[model samples]
Target: MRALIIIDVQKDFLANGFLVVPEGEKVIPVINNINHHFDVVVATKDWHPASHKSFACNHHEREVGEIVEVNDLPQILWPAHCVSNSDGAKFPEDLNTKVIEKVFEKGTKEDVDDYSGFFDNGKLNDTGLHDYLQSKGVKEVYVAGIALDFCVKYTALDAKALGYKTFMIEDASKGINFRPNDVQNAIIDMKVSGIRVIHSRELEKVFSGDY
Candidate 1:
């Protein structure tokens, strides 16, 4: 069956919040429209801890946007965002959450930074997102929401590797920096990795009752 994966459409990613992505809130209406067309709606949230190493605040001498290697993975130091139970961590109230059957919380552990909904720092950890989706018989996934360069892009790539036919709705996503090239690069990466990248308008033709 086809599932809609909404990645980190949270208040923190909005215009006035910390770590806001440019025009991030604009994708909400598009995501809402897409959610109704799919059978299963899976939403992911960036539920990080205050001491999460991915945050620059946790690094004594590091500044935001600095790249540091952690566990052999390149980790970008971000402004403190989406700490668990904080206002920034909650999904946007404007988003229609009723249709979301499953909610996956990522980046909970202070040690690991989870950009993908399926795994933490590209590894399977405490989050049971993959198993939950498998239990629901989800085979093909259509992804949308938040920053295209980080969360959304990584999630799409990981979904493809997990043996699911993945698609990212281009128009329904926005980038962190107002960088158009990053979005274009992500589209290329998705395509080369065998993941489909299409505009939101094309979703109806691509997504039918069955995969």
Candidate 2:
């Protein structure tokens, strides 16, 4: 069976929000259109605490975009977005949440940051996503959402490592691109790790039994 994973399509990552991903809003329509094609659709959210260590504001000396070590994992200091129960943490109003079968919340721990839907950055704790997918008999996963270079990339890589056939819906995702070529490098890394990167249109053919 195939599953569709929507990674962090929250308000904080969209335009007019903190830590905005360039053209992030553009992926929503594509995601909505492709969601129904998969057998199961799951969504992941970065439900962090206000004092989460990943937030740059929590560290006095560090600034947003700065890197620091938290719980032995290299963490990027972001602008305190996606606090639990906050508007920023909620999925955008336009996202087709009705099609999502399960919603997995990650990064709830105040001490560690979870960039992957499957596990925390340290790999010490899982968000229960892998087990859930396995229980559902999901053999292939198609991922799409905001910030392709970060959460989406990590999730796809973890899925591949966990023995699932992973494919990244390139056009259905966007990235922050903090550094030059960050998005491109992420795509290369994912491909190198055996994740198939394809556009949403290509996936449409697969869903329609034309591929």
Candidate 3:
């Protein structure tokens, strides 16, 4: 069975939100439409604490997008976003959440940042997403969501490494960094790890037989 893994499609990633991804809002319709064709739909949300170490607000010298070494891991300091119980953490109002079978809350710990839905940065713990999908007998996963160079890329890499046939729908993802060739770099990385990259409109052709 195949599943659609929607990562961090939250209000905070929208145009008006704290840490908006460029053109992030454009992916919603594509995600909503493809969700109907999948056997299972799972979503991930960034549920962080206000004082989470990943936030630039918590680090005096760092600014948003500044990279720092934390616990020997390269961490990007972001503006405080997706705080649990806050409006920014909520799913985008237009996202079709009713069809999502499982909603995974990640990055809640004050010390660790979980960019991938599969595991935390240090691989300290599982998000339980992989096991959950396996338990449901899911063999293939198609990933879509905000921040293509971060969450979306890491999730796809982890999924592909775990032996799932993973595909990343590029049109359904946006980059927060807006770095030169970041999207292209992510595509190259995904391909190197054996993950297929495609546009949302090509899903029908890529995953045939009713998806």
Which structure among the candidates has the greatest TM-score? Answer: 2
The TM-score obtained by model 2 is 0.96
Clashing pairs in 2: none
| Candidate 1 lDDT, 89-127, residue by residue in tens | 888888999999878999998877998888888485846
The 10-residue segment of model 2 with minimum total lDDT is 202-211
For all predicted structures, in order, the TM-scores are: 0.93, 0.96, 0.96
RMSD of each: 2.1, 1.3, 1.7
Question: What would the TM-score be for candidate 3 when compared with the true structure?
Answer: 0.96
The true-structure Cα RMSD of candidate 1 reads 2.1
Of 1 and 3, the candidate ranking higher by lDDT: 3
Residue 210 of model 3 has an lDDT of 52
What is candidate 2's lDDT per residue for 48-160, written digit by digit as tens? 88999999999988899899988788888899899999999989999889999899999999999898999998899999999999999999999899789999999999999
- Residues 1-211 of candidate 3: C-alpha lDDT, one tens digit per residue: 9899999999999989999888999989989888987999999999999999999989888888888877899888888999999999999889999999998988988888999998999999888999899999999999999789999999999999999999999888887765788888988999999998888878878777554
Give the local distance difference test score of model 2. 0.92
Superposed Cα deviation of residue 144, candidate 3 (Å): 0.2
